[model samples]
Target: MPVKIRAATQHMAMFSVDADAAQAMIDYSGLRVCRYRPNRAVAVLMLMRYIDGDLGEYLEYGTNIMVNPPGSNESGMRALQSAGAFIHHLPVDQAFTLEAGRSIWGYPKVMADFTVTDGHHFGFDVTIDGQFAVGIDFRPGLPVPSRFTSKPQVHPTYSHLDGVTRETAGEMTLSGVRYRLGGATVRLGQHAYAAELASLGFPKRAMISSSADNVEMTFGDAKEIA
Candidate 1:
């Protein structure tokens, strides 16, 4: 019997913010994806990160602003009035996940879970707490100005099985996919995951690329299952 092959494409983005800020910015309005073949599958994913600053900034008044207040405005003046000098260690870490059209199939599935320690320390006081948002906008094909950007007719089925465990601080295995949560350990997984990643021009250490820019990563550790 002759063998049949199928192909899929994906795009993704991951963003992070601090906890002291009153609100976070998410701009997914500018994203693009290209189709490799006429009938190949495609999808996109986006990840967001949020960090907490400190309690002092949180307690201070006039930290939240409706819009970008001018530096010479009253709001800016109030922000400075309550400002104080303090040092705090803030956590900076990445979170990964998938966001794409439900109709598209054969596209790579994405997942990410981890904990971040005090990744950075800032001497100056800065508010970090705030609302954050992650947005996704995916279509088909490269740069083009036309109606109905062609998409593959086929839709791939995804199996979101879960039963993995975090056996160590730097590693977590879920549904046969191993994730290197931290440290220098590298993760590996099935060919489907690897192939999807390669087609999207993802980084070598990525288990999956959650966006077009490959900013978010789900590190693939040694798998316990085939």
Candidate 2:
């Protein structure tokens, strides 16, 4: 049996960090300094172009980050505390608009525009819009590293036309099976698949379940899910 994919979408946004202002905020708050780009290994510009959606949603990356209170010693536990505060202050009123299109590689593409009030401000408002496409592929599955815990997974195996893109590719993993972008192979785990989706900005509260013959993903709101 093959796994079935229901819906896929994209989001994009543009943002700027006032490094000087952020530094001042850190100083005033007595918090440890943090960089706008927390994940130094990944290319911010490349991700911006690839993600291709609202600016507010994709602009900020990484987990909880915060400025330590002024005069407080920079200790690991204190830093974690500040991080928790940062999470508590996240902005929730962001909006996005998406326009559908196709990528150069014939993958589905969505054009998006995004904006944030102030990156330096805790819980700044943001807006975004973007497009995404999902389809079937015939790529081979890759092996999962042994250090991880969980059974291996595989890609959905089926052939049908849903008026989606005929040609599309991106990495996908399910049930411990890893699937290559544009390829139809899967070799990873279910948990890994769910984690990847969440990391990519999928709604965390959404339900992901599987039957013997199919995989199911359900979101609360249609607008948010698409």
Candidate 3:
């Protein structure tokens, strides 16, 4: 199969977690977490609006634990550097993408109701299985050099299955990008899955940012983690 491409606008944030707690999430993912210290790891919360893709328009909510590439000690850099995300939870607004994501990449995606509103800032509300899961409010910050203008990025990600795990690699490009660091408000509700995210310290906002416009991504095939 060929790489699946999507045009999107995304809101992302990074935060510090109790390294032990973050490690627990990584361990649960069946992939090892690279420690910044003896007990510290990083968590990323992403909300995406897919304007065009194989499945057309949809919304995706990803809660991820950023880890090192399998056995590599690349932790000397930043967490997002690896892009080897251990997806803690991924919720989307459509079944087509849900089926495609799972069948193509082994992504643990499910259907949900999503309201992603973007303007002066970006915000989203997501509900899964008829329960409120998460809500986030983000403010745009400043412009940094565009990565989409530079070389494309190939990110390797890991997902767990029955007694085994898989690896999915993706390449991404973006344009007309303006980066900013600002404030975020995250609400973790009473849903069971929502609680699972809370366990990873979702409420604490360490870093928040937004892209003003022009972003695209191509997600490639998923392979076995060897």
Candidate 4:
């Protein structure tokens, strides 16, 4: 109850990775990777700056792969629509959020430094212990399909770490959402889990989108993933 559910600005670049590679990553955690096709998986790289929240203000860089638990239907539509994202790497600039997120949702959050700027584009760089981990430069101002926000994008995520697995449902609403097939630069470093990006052929320039305004969001308490 200490964490505040508030507004935040989010920037993201989505990529299609080799389904086998992504499935390997998910397999390590005992989860199943959700595939858009038989051989491709969706990966989302995000940079978020909270304008106002229970933890005040902070920036976070997240690398997530869409996935579902073993029993979940693996059919593209059912799998992709579950909102069962698996967090592979997460770094936050604030300790308050780091602890709160991990305690509440089993989010794999670690303390780090983040630099963000925007003008003609949305940009961010995340550093942990003076080493670059990930960065993104994205262009906004694109057309969004009416169906993109036609319904609430609410879904549950399952996080498994340190021998524990937790599930939390989050309903996210992004204002001024814009969609585009390309127009973003992504960078992944060699340190830590950042190196894993290479296996997915990350920064390959795929689907990109952005929201100039705030992200309306809420997270439910964690429950053991079934």
Winning candidate number (TM-score): 4
The top-ranked prediction according to lDDT is: 4
TM-score, prediction 4: 0.90
Q: Candidate 1 lDDT (Cα, whole model)?
A: 0.20
User: Higher-lDDT candidate among 2 and 4?
Assistant: 4
TM-scores for the candidates: 0.17, 0.19, 0.89, 0.90
Error of 4 at 79 (Å): 3.3
Clashing residue pairs, backbone N/CA/C < 3 A, model 4: 4-54
Query: Which candidate order results from sorting by lDDT in descending order?
Result: 4, 3, 2, 1
Encode model 2's per-residue lDDT on 92-122: one tens digit a residue: 2222312111212221223322232222221
Worst 10 residues of 2 by lDDT: 40-49
Write one digit per residue (lDDT tens) for candidate 4, span 86-147. Answer: 88788998888888788777888988887777787778888888898888788775856656
Error of 1 at 22 (Å): 40
Ranking by TM-score: 4, 3, 2, 1
CA lDDT of every candidate: 0.20, 0.24, 0.73, 0.76
User: In terms of TM-score, how similar is model 1 to the real structure?
Assistant: 0.17
Runs off by more than 4 Å, candidate 1: 1-37, 50-159, 162-196, 199-226
Residue 194 in model 1: lDDT? 32
The candidate 4 region of ten consecutive residues with least summed lDDT is 143-152
The superposed Cα distance between candidate 4 and the true structure at residue 180, in angstroms, equals: 1.5
Cα lDDT tens digits, model 1, 1-226, are 1111122122322111121221211011111111122221122222223122111111110111121111222223233232221101111222121222111211122332222222221011112232121112222223332222232222111111232211100111111111121112112233343333333333222222221111111212212111
